[model samples]
Target chain A: MSSLDIRNLEIHVEGKPIVKDFTLNVPKGEVHALMGPNGSGKSTLAKALAGHEDYQIVAGEASLNGQNILKMEVDEIARAGLFMAFQYPSEIPGVSIANFIRAALTARLADNEELDAARYYRRLYEKMDLLKIDRKFTARSVNEGFSGGEKKRCEILQMAMLQPHFAIMDETDSGLDIDALKIVSHGVNTMRGPDLGILLITHYQRLLDYIVPDKVHVMWDGRIVRSGGKELALELEEKGYDWVKEEVAVV
Target chain B: MPATIEQETTNHSIDFDREVGNFKYKEDYSYDAGTGLNEDTVRYISGVKDEDEWILNFRLKALKVFESKPTPTHWASKDLESIDYSKIRYYLSKGQQPSRSWDEVPDDVKETFERLGIPEQERKFLAGVEAQFDSEAAYSNMKARLAEEGVIFVGSTEGLKEHPEIFRKFFGKVIPTGDNKFSALNSAVFSGGSFIYVPPGVHVKQPLQAYFRINAENFGQFERTLIIADEGAEVTYMEGCTAPKFETTTLHSAVVELVALKGARIQYITVQNWSENVFNLVTKRGMAMEDATIKWIDCNIGSRLTMKYPGVILKGRRARGEVLSIALANNGQHQDTGAKMIHAADDTTSNIIAKSISVGQGRSTYRGLVQIPKHLKNCKNNTECDALLINTNSRTDTYPAINVRGNRNSVQHEASVSKVSTEQIFYMQQRGLSEAQAMSLAVNGFVNDLIREFPMEYSVELKRLIDLQMEGSVG
Candidate 1:
């Protein structure tokens, strides 16, 4: 079984530590929710694990399915079965979503081996339908001038197509309306199975209502201060983040 | 932080230099006018062509004009000062007539065009083909169906000899010998370029193509082309050019004139991929009559320095013109290209869109002009220039001169300068693309809109060229 393991990790941005001594282990067949407020190093951890050059890994280790992703390049980390769904997807003007996904899948092939175009398009159309995306959306530029809901749906669509061993979803619920949120949750739920592991990051507890997480971790400052089962998310939602600050102060 | 990004761009630009160089071909010239240009060179070229007295006089007058005019000092780049006119060979050719069959041409000459996929394209898509080797066309042919439609496609020399009634009337009328210094030079010693004429109300469905190859060292290629689309006729013409890599500088000066009569439509396209040692200076202009349409689509890549501005004159009421061009300047190259629109009649409209990319120490500039007189009522013009700089040393500039004399005329000009964002590259990398692939995709996207304007086959070829250039730059 595949798993993503982070051990005593410390990440810094511009020479300042953001995520300190963070540890998390997500095995296949389960989903873990990482709930944190703004500037709590949630996005920093995601970027660091994705091998972004700006997020410096100071005294940290991240491995995906027994492969040390920290030693690999950004593209290599992606090809090593780790995916990071961005909070703010970049706008690639003139590049269609169909071509982008095709390139990603083509990268996974062995050298000199070409992807089967007919089969690839068939599978792509199927996944796009499952995500409720119109076939015309494939011709539009990647994330260019897309609404908040469309961007989130696009990220989930990519996750479904790439079928990575582990996916780190960063703020996939932000800016999405109720209808869009349900559609996005449905797409994510449809992809969930015994072979996939998901790290769902969110600021509010609303996302948990749709896709129930097996584990919930409260991230304060730079580390996870509390962890529990699914009901903990509801209790934290009712108590508010101020309660977590006070509890951490007491600790 | 900006400095770091510039450094990365510089490192990537070196990769392109490694990818394109050292392409050479064997040279065989039966007649070489030798280096230098003067009355003797002009007289020799005229004598070899056995031209009429009027044509010979025209060459002499143009030679005098070329001698009187000096190279402009106020260009976007001062590389023009390095060109030595006396060191340039005015004419070089195999001294053979153009053949309609590929087997009749010499093997070496045929192989060059074959490698460039000329014959295959002619068979598959083109209605006619004209392949120029150095100073003269080596092979020229048109389909029988097109000939039956009264479409005239032949070398300029053949056109002048056989179709004097049409050739003489519009020969130098659109672009005169004194239009520019390069035009004057081309008028004096010009040799093999395509001459096409479409009959009235006839439409040539497939494109007519010409391929120009310069194989000799220090040789100069001056081809004069003229196309006349009669009233209500429609046609599309395309040309591609290349030269062998050499240490000594080569010169390519061409002059092209198009006349679209009343209600006629003509589309002219050129793709120039010269070697870095070649200096490409060209003058192309078209005249659009009442309700006529003229369009110029140009793509420039490679060459040490290129100075070309294709222009259109809307000389009659309701005439239309458009210019869509793309230029890429790699290391040690400068592309100074743009368009000119002149609205001389009522209800005339024109549009210009130019895009350029500068990598390493390369430079690109957009120089354009638009003129609308007070007498012209309801004239409109739009111009857009976009520049992409790939490194700190890469540079771009825009100089637009617009003269609208009437209050009823409307002219809009827009320009933008941008670099490939690092964030975009990072984002693509997160999707499993390598750094080079990411940069290539971004560059392709930057010009994607303009590329779509090209014909299907040319657009595909352009993408492949861009991919190769990107790989070299990033390597």
Candidate 2:
């Protein structure tokens, strides 16, 4: 299928179950918001999908556009058109943002192909403009001493530059202020189209108001407990997460 | 200028700075000092130059010092003992007096430089071929202009014979023979380096590049270089260090001395990438007079064991000194390098920034010494050394000796040893770089600021070496 299909994904961290029986399908041209409370394994699922070493994929299958991503290395999965915008983007002190993004783009090219430095810088500046980042930011070290909102916007900038088939934004809106959230959401919204799918994992309904996901799924205890349309986010936000826990208890 | 964003001034300039270079040519020498170190070896070398009695006496005294001092083992790796001083061929040459013009250079040597992809102007001086690239008219114009300005730039042998008034004054004075055992050895049998003298009050705009390449196998080992900047003059010099890969050549020890006179400035840069199995133990130091400045930017890669610590002695009031260096050690290699700043004058200042990366089973050590003695006033020193380890077995060590005992003197020394953070690599990989690429990026970032100080050509080579080393180590 032309989609990000993760089936029966079981993940563990340090031999402890973190994500269990996690199944989700985000097809092309769709934006799915995975909402969950703290410690509900939302970030772990994203890390495992991104092939992080610490997040062990004990038993599972994850595919991006019919390509088995679970069998790929972190970079290979990324090259397979799966993008992960980390909640805390690493502060690589000496690597410039422009060079980092260019490397990522270069890795996607076939052998003997070179990335045009001028064109790469031009495209990078455009993304930075879209994210309200300064042109000087490209020369600055990646996320070095960046404020919270700037880090989120930088993550969005990278997502826009890579233009992957599927992107998992893990709590991208967590640290952002209102203005930054608006800019970052605008950048993401500009990328939303028939060719792209997104799994926006977040805790608040604040971000939903800006981007408005096509589908909303509430995760509890390492699994998706409820799935519904866009209104589900508002309902959950209004009733609070304790409401879902008590309902699960009653069930 | 930082030279960080300097656009390449020429296209083909960096093509030669690519790898632990493998290009070689057949060896045909007419003059051979044979293998080994002895009084006769020293005598033979002095006789080859047909030097004065004083010079011969200097060599004889240095020979005694070289034999008297034991191998440095207190702080050096045990690998220092493996070099059989006798087995190393002391000298080899084609027996041709270096023609005063590039056109007179041997055809084979020219062809070798051409095959090595050496640029035209670089090739001429690299072979001690007299810096004449007639085909490159613009370079000739610069050379003529420099000559008109009374600047003296020539091979060391030519400088000593023709302009002894200037060359002899500062020779062996900045770094004496007893400085180290290797220095003593180089003092006895030195060859194949440059002598540059900038006149008073003149500013050389472009950097002067001179080569003491171990290009021909066993052709040159102990190279001696000296540069003198007179009052209020300034110059920048680049020493290109390269060796054709082979099994025979093993030892390379060079002694370089720089003198920046009153109110002058001198910047010396060296980018050395020797072939495998080469032991590059070099002694380089500069002396700064009143209100003068001396800066050394060094980058070391590709040798089996490199122990180089470029130093400066600030002897004049208000003098300044700096050493910015980067070293990369790959598998089966050890890069033991650092810097030393000795402030002997009042109100002098110095800054030392050193960064190194160790890949696979390689090891890097930063051994620095900053001495502001008990009597200097208002002297300040800042030393920052950072190391990055690429693999689990990769190693790095920092041994800094900062002695600032005097009143009104300040010294700051900061050292950090870090491994390439797995999270950082993962983050980079998640965006799509291979593990090796990711690791190399982390390393480049670690040494980014220092690389900026290197000339664009050397920085490009430095980055390529890092990438190649990472590719081999990370799978």
Candidate 3:
């Protein structure tokens, strides 16, 4: 069974603390949701876990299946069965989506092994179809001149293709309409099974409504203040962030 | 003198005014340029060639004109003053005769050409090849099929001997030696370059390439090339150049003239990867007659300094010219290349696109000229020049001269210079590519549109060269 453990994690960006003493664990066969408001450090926790260069890990420990992720490089952390779907994905012009994904997959293969173009295309078309994406998108540059909905869907497509042990999706529902959210959630839901674990970071309960999680935690000021079952998301959404602030202040 | 001879004499006079004497080869063959230019050198060269009295007198007169002409003073790069005429060994020949087979050539010279992949390319792709060692072609060959088709491929010296009438008619018409300082030098001692003639209504599909190599030190390579495509014919020619790196710089001055007759099309492509120790100054021009087309596809990858401007003259109504060029200047290189188009007939059109990449203090400049005479009722021109600087130390300059004398002509010119931003590199590295790989990808993308014009093999080779240039370039 695969597992990820974060203990006493503290993150800083530009000399300011963002994620402080945050601890979480998700083993295989389960999905966890970290719900919080704006400026609550949830996204910071996700990025720092993914080894983003901009986020400095101060006094924290992150391990992926017994390997210290914090000690690895960005690409090394990625190839080590840890995937992070960014909130604002960068647009790389002149690099086609097909070639981008192919390079990533090529990196995962052994040095002597070669990617079979025929089989690769067949599988790519199948996943794109499942996500309701046109096959012509393979020729277009990666996320270049793409709509917000297309970008989010492309992120999900990458997660499905990479098939990591644990994925941290940050604000996957941002800027998506009802139909896009359903399609994106469906792609993630189809990939869910006993061999995968997901940490879904969202500012609202709208995304959890589609891809139901096994556990939900309310985070305030970089720390988880409340924990419950999936229904916790609905209650938080109804009561708004003020309720979380009041609950945390009382605690 | 007869009217024809008088006209010829006047043409020679004008040529002499613009260039140095052509007898530099003859003098070197006999007495050599003794310390400096003198009447003895001119007489010795004319004596060796066994030229007519009129030709001898023309050389003497051209020598006088060359002596009177002053050196150019307005060069932007002040380093031109370092070329000492007296110090330069004008010409040298390994053999008195041009060999028809590679086996008959000299050993050292043949080995030099063979090591540069000339023989391999000739065996695989070319229908003919003229290999020049110094001032003369050491070996030349043409397929029997092409000979049967009346395709004449020979050395320029052979052209001067066998086809004097055609050679004399158009030799100095396109670009006279007086056009530039280097042209003057080339005219004085120019020796071996490819001379191709496609008979009327016969098309030569394969390329006719020439390989020029500089073996000896303090030597100069002045090769003169002429290509004429007859009516209803098509030809594509490619020329490649190389030289062994030497401590003292070698001068390579070449003059190339092309003529495409009515309804004819000619595409001239050059991939110059000269070592970064040679001064390559070449003047190549073409005249497109009525209903003809000319295209120049040039790629400059390595050279200490190269100044090449391939020009096209639209002499016939509805003639067209286009040039797609890419120049990559690595360390200690300066690539100054562009195209020139002169529209003289109605309904003429020309297009020029140039791209350059500068890295590690390497400099690149685009110097282009487009002219449409007032007499031409309807003419069009479109010029685009783009420069990409790889580092802050590198620089690029664009000097485009657009002269439209008639109101009916349409001219468009656009230029942009940009340096590869750090943001671009960071973003690419974030996608898992190395810094070097990212730089290469960005450079490739910058010139992707122009590179698509090359053949598959050439495009692959160009990418490999660019990758080599980008390796270890990041700080």
Candidate 4:
């Protein structure tokens, strides 16, 4: 079993601290929902975890399965079973989705071992079918000219194919309509198993309604101030983030 | 470095102004034809090659045609009077045979090719690579698997010697020596360009590459290349050229002929980044048989004056031809390149797309031609030429001639010339990418359609090339 541990991590953007003393741990077979208001350092945490160059880790440790992920390159961190579904993924022109995934898979192969093309296509088709993606999506350039729903579906498709041990999905439902939300939720739900741990970071509880979480944590400022059962998401949805902001201020 | 080597090389031609001047080649490789144009120079060149009596007479005959043929006075900035044929070294070889193994090469020439990443590429990605230094191929390599498939890759000289029958049949069929003055020059002294032959039904998945390096100044490096794809065969050939910067100019004239047999497909890609003091004039043309396809992808980045037009003759029904060109001309450079397509049979299709980037007093021109006979039916031709000027002093011109005698032929020509506006730069800078990166991206986007046709590895290299060229380009 694999787990991700973020302990006392401080992240800075442009030399200004954004995520201060933030700590979160998700063990294997757990779903953790991070609920935060806008500008509450939610995206900063996601960027920091994904090793984005802009987000500098000034202090603290981020590890995956006892391996120091901060020491790894972005691609290495990805191949090491840490998947971050970007809020705004880059559109690499002239590189199709199939090629991108093929490159990622090829990078994981041993020096002498060759990728089984037949097996790769079979698995890719199966994952695409599960995610309700058109087979033609493989030939399309990554994220180029994709709609909001298509981008979200593409993200989920990548998540499904890569089969990471832990996934940090940042606002997967943002800009997604109801149908897209259902499709995306279905994709995430299909991947849920004892071998997978999910950290779903979202602004609204609507996505939580579809892919019910195991735990909910409300983030205020740069830290998670409150933690509760699944009922916490419902409470926050009804009361809204303003209540959390006031509650954190009183504390 | 050494006196004899330096003197024999004639390393410096010095400043002779804009006019091509008299500078005799001191190299022993040159066969003297005396002071004026005569039968002796032609006879001397033919005797050096030990050509067939018929070929020697053909050279003698071509000399008359060369004397009678008029210079291309219609083309802009073509001062043919400046080129002094007597001064140039027609051919020079340092006695190095094209070696299949790197260890067999001479140390100095081997070091030159090694610095340019020749043998290393052969070991990694290239299925076969021919490295030509000056006038002779120094090294050649082909993977064992490709050799077993009966795909022949060798120097043109070896092709002439080993495969005489095949070489004799198609030597000058597509672009004869009398086609142009440069072609005539190349025919007179051509030495070591790649010769490729793909066997019937064989598809070479990896591209066979050739790298030509010119290290001697005032010396003319004329290489001849011939690639034939047999019936139902498919192959891709890539060629790259580079030279060192010199105060004196060097000359490089090459002739490349390709034949795609019935139902065959051939793709020829050239990325020429010659030094800013080389006159790169090359003639490349191909012939396509019934249902065959031929493509030429040429990218010219740097040269003092480069005039190359890779053309195709669709001689059989349902044949197809395509040319995608990207020319980037910087200061003191003039890149004049385009394509030509001739449809002789019914239902032939051709497409020509050329993009040019000019910066800092550079001049680039696209001169293209497409012709369809009166009897041919349903011939289609689409030509698009675009130019991007990076500065006020930079200039670009487009001259496209489409002659479709048949009523059924459909031809389209579109052209646009635009300068990189400061507003776009400001807008892109507001985003993350820098000015150079933005310019590079824009230039890449202009040719993105053509770039998509390249393999992934080549596309990356092409992007990096554009980025390197865009550095310090912003005003």
Error of 2 at B370 (Å): 2.1
- Where model 1 places Cα greater than 4 Å from the true spot, the runs are A110-112, A115-118, B1-22
Q: Give residue B282's error in model 4 in angstroms.
A: 1.3
DockQ of each: 0.40, 0.69, 0.16, 0.03
Give the best candidate by lDDT.
1
Name model 4 segments beyond 4 Å from true: A1-251, B1-45
Instruction: Report the C-alpha displacement of residue B224, candidate 4, in angstroms.
Output: 1.0
lDDT for each residue of candidate 4 in B12-111, tens digit (9 for 90 to 100): 2211111111122223433333433467755765665666787676666666776777767666456445566666655566653578789998777777
Candidate 2, clashing residue pairs? none
Q: Write the per-residue lDDT of candidate 1 for residues A108-166, one digit (tens) a residue.
A: 88898866666666787888898789888887889999998899899988888899888
| By lDDT: ranked, best first | 1, 2, 4, 3
User: Per-residue alpha-carbon lDDT of model 3 for B54-146, expressed as tens digits?
Assistant: 555655655555556665547545555555666666556755467888888767666666666677768767888888876778888988999
| RMSD of candidates 1 onward, in order | 5.6, 3.6, 9.9, 11.4
lDDT, residue B132, candidate 1 = 94
Off by over 4 Å in 2: A242-251, B1-17, B99-104, B120-142, B215-220, B245-249
Could you tell me which 10 consecutive residues in candidate 3 chain A have the lowest summed lDDT?
Answer: A91-100
Whole-model alpha-carbon lDDT for candidate 2: 0.83
Off by over 4 Å in 3: A1-12, A18-35, A39-86, A89-93, A99-127, A155-172, A188-201, A212-232, A247-251, B1-75, B79-93, B96-116, B131-139, B214-219, B244-248, B392-394
Q: How much of the real interface does each model capture, measured as fnat?
A: 0.70, 0.90, 0.07, 0.02
Pick by DockQ: which candidate is best?
Answer: 2
Q: What TM-score results for chain B when candidate 1 is compared with the true chain B?
A: 0.94
When just chain B is superposed on the true chain B, each candidate scores a TM-score of 0.94, 0.91, 0.88, 0.89
- By the DockQ metric, which is better: model 2 or model 3? 2
